[model samples]
Target: MSEILRLDAVSRHFSGLKALSGVTLRIDKGEVLGLIGPNGAGKTTLVNAVSGVTPASSGKITFMGRDITGIKTYQAARLGLARTFQIVQPFAEFTALDNVAAAALFSQPGESLKSAREEARAHLAFVGLEAQAGQSAATLTLAMRKRLELAKALAMKPKLLFLDEVNAGLNSAEVERATQLIHQLAASGITIVMIEHLMKVVLNVCTRIAVLHNGVLIADGPPREIIKNPAVVDAYLGHQYAQRNAAHG
Candidate 1:
């Protein structure tokens, strides 16, 4: 597995406050990398910088072996990088199929509306939303909306997909479904970088986990090792779990 995405000494600041501090990480081809942290820990900021939404203060981002530092958000998509937002951004009035079609158009050149629609249908089916193809985006439930977000991102034919908290606010079953979809994506050779809060989902789906704290990388390893890292326990996994572990010892 070759490295598909790499960030070197990346940092982001807002109004002189650091959002990400010298964060460095890599996502290899055909791997699912989980990014986990408490709120304000710079998980999303690091993602935004990589996806070109926010410019890094100082660093380099390489995608598919090309330097994509400071690349435009839209242009990144053209280069086989696509992302789903933490907040689902559907064209409210469009049908689910239309929403996906819009993304299919963003793929490679020589895509027609009809051709995009056909590809969009496949994406919708992949997300288990084929039945909702004709339904208005605003009419879908929250879980379905998140699925739609995944479908739309997939429609772009991305090689590297950044999923931003797609499991947030879903029930257990919904999370399981999302996990399965992600598993399918990885099986099909789409490298995934997921930002998720749910530890169980991360453990189940991620090949490797990266922990961020105070705008920096604190830990990165296999799921079980990351969970056991003392720094991770101190930084993000509150005292309750740690205290319980100590008591049992």
Candidate 2:
């Protein structure tokens, strides 16, 4: 598989506090890479920089062999990179189809509204929102809203998709559905880089897992090894078990 995206020595600072430190990673064609970390680990920041939601302090970002550093978000979208926000932001007043249509409009190549809406309907169905297409986005349940967000991102027809904390607020069943959809997307040839808090979701869908702690990458390996990393256990899982273990000890 070819390299679809590369982040070289990526670093970001806010008021002298480092949010991401020399984070270098690559997304290869047809791979699902998981970004896992405790809160404040800079997982979202890394995604933001790649998606051009924020300018990186120092880094080189390349997409499909083209330098895309500091490019506008929409331009990045046009370049076959799409992303979903941690917080699902839909056009509340619009129908599910309309919300997707808005995304399609932004992704439209030749500036035709008709063609965009036509494409949007297909994406909504792809995310399993076809039955709710005519309902207002505001009226949808949380799970449905999440699916709509996925549909909106998919409407961009991305070669590489960045999902940030997509499973954060979902129940087990919803997360399972989301995971299956992600698998489907991967099967259809979309390389995915997902930042998720739900360990199960990451382990189930990702081929490789990348762990971050205090804005630094500490582990990059398969799920089995990653979950066993002493560093990862120290950073996130220690507190939950240390007290209990001490009580028993």
* Steric collisions counted per model: 0, 0
Task: Flag regions of model 1 displaced more than 4 Å.
Answer: 242-249
Give the per-residue lDDT digits (tens) of candidate 2, residues 1-249: 789989898889999899999888887899999998888999999888888888789989999999988988889888888999988989999999888888877876675777777777898888888999899999999889999999999988899999988887888898888999999999999999998877667878999988888778888888777776788879875756445544754
- The residue pairs in collision within model 2 are none
TM agreement with the true structure for every prediction: 0.95, 0.93
lDDT (C-alpha) at residue 109 in model 2: 62
C-alpha RMSD by candidate, in order: 1.8, 3.2
lDDT of each: 0.90, 0.86
Clashing pairs in 1: none
TM-score of 1: 0.95
By TM-score, the best candidate is 1
Model 2 regions lying over 4 Å from their true place: 109-111, 239-249
Query: In candidate 1, what are the lDDT values of residues 10-66, reduced to their tens digit?
Result: 989899799999988888899999999899999888878887899898989999889
Candidate 2 clash figure, as a count: 0
